[model samples]
Target: MNLQRFEQLIAAYGSQAHHWPVAERQAALSWLQQQPDNALYCQAQQLDMLLNQSVAPLPAPQLYANILAKICPTPFRDGYFYLCHWLWGESQWQHCWRPALLLGLPLLLGLFASGLSTPSVEDLLWLDLEQSWVLMMAGHEMDL
Candidate 1:
């Protein structure tokens, strides 16, 4: 129905048309017939022929060993190997959100609640008046 489904059907059954389910093969042929002569159709035919070719056989045991050594080199390399060292070494806590939420949300809530309960202008004025009265009383006592 979709392009992906068409591609899957082609990959699974297109390589050997004779092996395809008869009804499905007929349906696919009918669909391809509906499309005009196009570049994609030509390219698909060429690639299908290319995939069917067989390579020449390999030589002796030494040749096989040489090929294997060339294809599969040593995996370890020094330049970036030390950078891969783990700090916590795969702890289960790294995958968890509960601890971060437990620590973070209360701190955020405390800050938000602190902002809401901050002293008003009137409270500041009263504190200022109290301090001034103390200073005036201290001055009076000193004068006496």
Candidate 2:
């Protein structure tokens, strides 16, 4: 690799050769060997040593409680939230059919009930014939 690229690798992955990506590790090593007195490499090594010695700060004692409070506000509402979470967290194909079945079952039942309640074409034709027979008898009685 070129000097500029070697400097970039050192900046991104730290001064340690092991930290560098496997593909570019050999190229960076060869470049470093050619320039044994690289100022950037020395500076990066110093920075890495300082960072390695530093300790991370601990979180607050109430952090877990605060996160839980934000995620689930009320104990009673937690059940509904959990149920929805479980339903949606499944695989995409499985989750898609659940809501469809829930809504479609009620819609199908309503359609079936309506079909049962409505009169058929044969029933309407028979009712019309009975009405006509009654009207014809009434006309004959009026003539008499």
Candidate 3:
């Protein structure tokens, strides 16, 4: 893979490098092994050290309360801010409708516009399949 994509994969694995897919982990490891003096090798070493450091554990009860507070705020049962955050946090749903519209709108507009512009094959009977093919094949006909 390209260096940029390799770097992205490393970043995604983050502090949980061990959690990276086995095949990808091996590939990264192999690439690094092959290039001990590579600039990326130094970066990878720093990243590995960063991943090895331990994070301070939070109290389960406090963590749960914090998560709930963020998801379901205190102002109301259905708080505007909470709902907005929820929608924004999971933006895949927003993109679902967007892609449909992006694809469907162009298709629909093309169909509508075609109706207003061109006649169907049946309507243009003078230019039958045989006649059209002959004209195309004839090129610039003989001078005679």
Give the lDDT ranking, best first. Answer: 2, 3, 1
Name the best candidate (by TM-score).
2
Instruction: Identify the candidate with maximal lDDT.
Output: 2
Per-residue accuracy of model 2 over 32-109 as CA lDDT, tens digit each: 888978988998999999888999899997998889888867876778788777666588986888777766899999
The per-residue C-alpha lDDT of model 3 at residue 86 equals: 53
Residue 112 of model 3, lDDT score = 97
Residue pairs clashing, model 1: none
* Candidate 3, 49-84: lDDT as tens digits: 875787997688888888988886578756877665
Considering lDDT, which of the candidate structures 1 and 2 is the better prediction for this target? 2
Query: Which scores greater on TM-score, model 1 or model 2?
Result: 2
TM-score of 3: 0.29
